[model samples]
Target chain A: MLYLVGLGLHDEKDVTVRGMEAIKGSERVYLEAYTSILGVGKERLEAFYGKEVVVADRDMVEMDSDEILRDADKVDVAFLVVGDPFGATTHSDLLLRADALSVPYTVIHNASVMNAVGALGLALYNYGQTVSIPFFTDSWRPDSWLERVRENLRLGLHTLCLLDIKVKEQSEENLARGRKIFEPPRYMSVPCAISQLLSLLEEEGQTPAEASSDDAVALNPATTLAISASRVGAPSQRFVSGTLEELSKLDEEAFGGPLHSFVIVGRRFHALERDFAVRWAVDKDNWNQVSNGVYKVRD
Target chain B: MLYLVGLGLHDEKDVTVRGMEAIKGSERVYLEAYTSILGVGKERLEAFYGKEVVVADRDMVEMDSDEILRDADKVDVAFLVVGDPFGATTHSDLLLRADALSVPYTVIHNASVMNAVGALGLALYNYGQTVSIPFFTDSWRPDSWLERVRENLRLGLHTLCLLDIKVKEQSEENLARGRKIFEPPRYMSVPCAISQLLSLLEEEGQTPAEASSDDAVALNPATTLAISASRVGAPSQRFVSGTLEELSKLDEEAFGGPLHSFVIVGRRFHALERDFAVRWAVDKDNWNQVSNGVYKVRD
Candidate 1:
């Protein structure tokens, strides 16, 4: 049997009791490492589970999945994911492969950022289609996500922007020459994402429709309320709510580490939700000023 | 410290190792039992952790919370929730009470239906604002959720409709007479939800706006595609996708048991998602005809 176990969001202990039991009973355990990172190291997980975990990078999981599924029909082999097994499309693809190979599998579910972002006091039901913000290169910068955010805003739904993390990425030159060398890992921070968003707006300013009418754009950085959260589901997690302009100018040290997420607050706000979210603001007075100005609707 | 530990979707074993450790170390463990149900009883969880578990109902949690948090400042107290601790607003209110009392707390996150619904092969990012369907009565049938569904459809986003569960609820007469008598639990099944939705559409036909134009309405029972899932994350889980009209007539026994969810498929369909969803259709040929006719967009 092939076990797709979720390691929750934090350290080794985040794995469910059922997941632990499966791992202990498995002959081989593989950790898919590229999609997300855990707070603890591989060795810490090995020490806790008393099993050597093979680290599977993107190439291995995407290309050599057969090897991971090898002997699974006879023995229990565990493939561990940092979040829920189905959090990423690659893991779902793996499940499809297992079905094709006639290998029975069990998925042990855990918390993913898709749901964990509710910790920000925003109603999960109020969120619209989530968007991912990739690191903008000089040659490649896409602003398609802006449309999604706009649609969400039009419907008074919160937008969760999942900041990108580039791990073991190769440069264009390296990829062209087929070099195996990888660059240092880079995790997108809140300020970086805000800057990209601001640039997109600046670019939109040049467009005829945007220049002719201010009402055409849904979001204005100076007035729009947003929340910047870092290391959610971790003990040291921090969240700050304010206007986009204020968030864009926020100090890098305010959000201490990797895995930052941003939420563009929608127009609809329940009094309770607003009060709860205000408690996490970097500047509570400013948050109230901007939020009240932007979100006039009340429950 | 107060620990809000999540018992992931299924049985007692679904609790994380960290949650188990917290339960074992706690002087008192209370399971919040109103928002969602667990496959196992309190006794099973108690036996698994070798600790006395207290079942905290809605009254105990809302009215008698002080008793639950009594001496929590000095003793380790664990409040176990069926899914992620913050899945419901009540839990967040409890957290606020803890804060008011200056009690430090830790959240042990686990799977919630908000994320676990990804088992339907739909991208988590593609879902819009989730709506809940309450049991319809002769006089209290509100169809506000139809507007949310229409908005999601306009944005080409999937809608996850959470079915309501009435557990330990008192009848109007009993409540008026101040009696403690409770009615038997009633979990809204897939068929019931579909019937309610269809009825809502039928009611819309009488409205002036809906009567004037057929294209203004977003959902059609005969053509709109949807997925019915039951006992998700449990071993006996089942999923069947088909047109709304077809699912409205689905066998009650086909879903197995309670905790059923319905996903109204949107216009956006990645070819892969369409293929994956079709595999679980009750009638593959009919599903293909309906889904293709409705969700024509392909990526």
Candidate 2:
């Protein structure tokens, strides 16, 4: 049996009973580490589950996946993901592989940041397509996500920007020379994502020279209401709301830790949502001024 | 402290370790019973946690919310929800009420149908705004969701249509005459949802004089590819994919059980998603015909 278990957001205690059972009973346990990370490390999960866990990086999962599935037809092999196993495409590929190999698998579901972002006092139903904001390189800066945000705006729906996490990634020098040296892990912070988004808007000619006065419209740097949330689904989860420019100028330390996510507020707000947003705002007075004053609302 | 614990999708065993601990340690445990339901009953939850779990229906939650939060400032109280605590707006209301009463709370996250829908071979990021398909009566057939689906189609993103579950609902006569008699719970099946959607499109004149030749776009009823999944996170989970017209013709038993969710495939497709969809398809031949033949692909 091949068990694709989700170690729900936060620490080891977030693992469900079924997932824990899969880990304890499996002959081999592999923690998928590249796509996302929990607050606790592999050692913490090891101590909690009382089993040795092998950390599977990008190479091991993408290239050496058959090793993880070896003997799975005879014994239980648990492949653990940070959140829900289906958050990334790699897990789907693995499921197909298991089907081809005739190894039946079960998915033990857990909360991912995709759903956990609702903790910021936003209703899940109001969100549009979820997008990822990657770390901008000196040479490679992708602006395709800008159009997605615009599309969400056009439809009057909020967009969830899942910040990127680069784990065990090598520098250009190492990759070009076929070396194995890896750079330190990078977790995109809320402020960094805001700044990158602002720059991308400018590059795409979406950000006007003079920002719009409307405080609620997204893609407008000066006034668009946005949220910066970190450590969601954890005990220390924190969320702050402000305009895009203000969020971009704030220090990353204000958000506390990694595994952050950002939200671009939609133009269409339910009456209850306005109240909810105010209650969860960073500065209630400022939120009130912006939301009640100039937040351009559509139906 | 009030613990808003999420009893994740499917069964009692799906609860996280932290959520379990919270349930055990709390002085009072209340299982929220209106918005959604777990596969198991309150008895199963009580047996697993070894605590008396009181079921809080819509009346208890919306009308008597103060009862749930009473004395929480002094004693630990656990209010359990079926999925992630924030999937419904009522949970947010409870949080606000707690805030009004100066009660501090913690949210223990768990899997929700919002993210669990990804297991059906579709990427999470590709989904557009999630919409609810409420049960329609002879008089009230809300078509607002139709516009949302159309917007998703316009943006080239898939739409996740969450079927409605009516729990502890009173009949109109009973409600008007001040009676407490409740109707049996009704969970909208996949076929029911599809039939409702098709009728709605026709009612709105979006069905056209004749159905389009296309098999990929939504709102056309005939050719739009869709997926019907049931018990997404459970051992007995089942999924069937076909064009909207064919899916509407399928019996409810095809999906096996309740807690079903439906997905309307987007006009755009990644090549990998095509293969994944085929692998998970109920009839791979028909899926290929719709996808490979006239299915529109937009970047």
Candidate 3:
């Protein structure tokens, strides 16, 4: 049997008990490391599981997954994901391939960024489509996500923005030379995301779609409410709420470290939501001013 | 410190190692029972933790959450929720109250229906705002959720419908008499939710909004696609896909037991999603026909 286990957010101890059982029962274990990483290193996981785990990179998982699944019908093979198994579409590809080989598989679900974003006091029911923000290069600046944020704002729904992470990536020159060199891993910080968002708002000016509806709103750098959450689900996780103008000015040391996510708050704010969010605001006076001017109080 | 722990979707064994540690070290352990439940009973949880687990009902948690935080500053108190602590807003109220009472707290999140719905082969990024479908009473047959589904379809986004769960509810007559008696728990089945969706579609004739857009779609009882997922994170979890009409006609035995959720498929159905979802179709021929007729296939 093939087992797709989830190592929940944070350290090795975050994995569920059933996940431990799957790891213990499997004849071979492989950790899919390209998509996301646990807070702790593989050595810590090995010490916790008391078993050696094979690390499967993006190439092996994408090009040679058959090797990972070999003899799975006869022996149990466990493929561990950093979050829930279905967080990315690539995991589903592996599961479907297992079906074609006539190997039965089980999915052990756990918390993922999709749900963990609710840790910032935003209701999951009020969220629209989830979007990902990639690092902006000099020539490749993708600001299409701003329109998605606008669409969500049109419906009074919050948009959860997943910051990008570049891990084990090769440069163009290295790929041509067939070198096995890799760059240092980089995780998008909340300030970088906020700056990109500000750039989008400035670039999309005067081309903004429908701005007349009573409940309709747009992303204004100074007036739009925003939130940044980093290292969520860990005990030391930090949440900082401010306007885009306030957040885009922060340095790297302003908040916690990597794997940060930014959120564009919707116009339909409730008193309860405001009450909870006020505690984390960089400027409570600015938050209240924006809440009074732009947000539509539900109750 | 107050610890808000999440007992993930399945049995007692689904709790994380950190959760177990928190339970073992806490002076008082209270399970929040009204928001949702674990597959196993309190006896099983008590046996696993080797301590008595206090069942905190909705009244106690909402009305007098301060009492739950009593002495939390002096000693550790663990209040567990079935899913993540933020799945329901009431948990936030408790946390805010803790902050007001000078009781520091930590949150341990787990799998929730919000993210667990991705198990049905749907992409989490494609989901719109989630809507809850309450059981329709004879006098109050509310269908506002149908408009929410339409709004989601207008944006080519899938809708995650949370089925209603009523537990330990007092009858109106009994409540009027000031009696503390409770009624048997009622969990909404997939068939019941599909029936309600069909009823709404039948009632909402011709009042539909702008349908001239190329991708705009409406919920047709005979053609629109739907999926029913039950007991999601458990090993025996089941997922079945069909049209509104086909799923509405199914008996209770067609799905697993309680805590079922329904999804209304949107227009943008990718080939990968279709391939994965086709395995759970009630009728493959009907699925293909509907796929060809209604779904906007995204290659």
Candidate 4:
């Protein structure tokens, strides 16, 4: 039996109980590392699952899936993914390969970013579309994502902007020359993304899509953006909500560290959400309204 | 400090070890239940966390966030959400509220479906926009999603169709009558979603979107869908890939149970992904060679 298990978002213990069972039962365990990875290291997962996990990079999974599937036919093999097993096409490919070999397989899904963007109080149903903002280069920065965000805003839909991550990426020259050179993995920051977005809005000629509501929430390319930085599953994770301009000026020191993402608020902000946003708006009083309640401690 | 932590996709185990530590250390732990839920039940999570969790519904969150934020000022508090905290905007609102109150807070992120959809080998970067296919009533079905999907198709980008889920929603009549009423939560199935899509396409006097793609992979409105059905994060999880028509005829007995989603393959199939999809194509041997290694996974 081949088991494809998701290792939630954080450290080792994020694996579901069923996934844990599969890991324990499997004759061999392979952790697919390229698709996505836990904030914590592999050793942490190994310590928690109490199993030695073979780290499978893109080469192993994409170039040598047959080897992984071959063992599945004879033994209960478990392939661990950082998010949902089917979260990446490569993982799906792995499943297809397993099925081709007539190996019975089960996918143990876990939380992925698709559903998690709701943390900003935006209705999941109200989000029109999601697009990734890639790191801008001197000559090859793209603005296609900006147009999509415009459409979502015009349609009264929120836009979830996924930042890009460059992992084990090879330069065109390296590939052509048959050299196994790789660029350092880089996760895009919110400021970098917003800057590129600004340039896109300029290039696209500033035509913001219209929204369903009477209010036109478009063309505010510099509108309020909710930013979250270093949201590792760790207790010290940090989130900041402010206008894109304010966020743009955010000191890297204040945001703390890497893996930052930004959200462009669209139309259809409920009155309740507006009230909440007001608290973070520039120069707002009664900030203490957020502090007038009872408290409880579990520990 | 206030902590908004994502519980990932499944059960208590889905919470990252970092999230677990935060929960263990927090003065209080409140599970936000209204936005979305883990595949596991409340009781199961409580048992695993070994803590008395306060269930905070929408009413408690939207109407009573002050109470939670106030506590955070004096002590550490953790609001647990399914998937990533930022996956939903309500959590973002909560963070903004916390910020206004001078409450130091953090966000522990998890995997949400946003980036996880790469499982279909669809380049996350290539996706133009995402649209939600809501549950259509006898008289109130909306076709706006169709227009949005059309725009995306024109741009040659993959679309992630998020099916709708109506939970704890009241009926129109109930709101007018001022009576406490409830409606059953409805999760949109891929077959029903396609049926609506086709109907709406015909209504718009447009050619069926499926016709543009190769017929084998193009799922007409009545086609059975390639559905991943099961408690994605739970133990008995299952993923079944099939046609929209075939999936529509699926015996409930065979699909296993609730919480199902479908992936509509886009036109631009990557070479490796096509290879994988061919293995699952309806006619494995007579597969269309889109590329060297890419094939659509058929139902």
Tens-place lDDT digits, model 2, residues A156-257: 778999888888888889999999999999899998888888887676566444433432333677667888778888888888888788788888888988
lDDT tens digits by residue: candidate 3, A196-262:
8777666655323433343345565777888888888877788888887888888878877887887
Q: What does candidate 3's lDDT look like per residue over B1-299, in tens digits?
A: 99988888988888888988898899989999986878889999999988789999989998988888999999999998897788855367888899989999988878888888888888988888999999999799987777777778888889999988899998999999999999999999988888777676666553234332433555656778988898889877899999888988889899979878888898767778887888999998888778766685655
Of candidate 2 chain A, the 10-residue stretch with the lowest lDDT total is A209-218
Per-model lDDT: 0.84, 0.83, 0.83, 0.63
User: Across residues B171-281, which tens digit of lDDT does each residue of candidate 1 receive?
Assistant: 999999999999999999999999998887787664524533433235767677898878878888888998888888877887878899989988766767777788798
Backbone clashes in model 3, listed as residue pairs: none
CA RMSD (A), model 4: 7.5
Per-residue lDDT tens digits for candidate 1, residues A119-237, read: 87788888889999988998899888988988888777889999999889998899999999999999999999999998888877644255435332347776678888788778888
Among the numbered candidates, top DockQ falls to 2
TM-scores of the candidates are: 0.95, 0.95, 0.96, 0.71
10 residues in a row with least lDDT, candidate 3 chain A = A206-215
In model 2, pairs of residues that clash are none
Q: What is the C-alpha local distance difference test score of candidate 4?
A: 0.63
Runs in model 2 deviating more than 4 A are A204-218, A296-299, B204-218, B296-299
Q: Model 1 Cα displacement at A230 (Å)?
A: 1.2
Rank ordering of all candidates by DockQ, starting from the highest: 2, 3, 1, 4
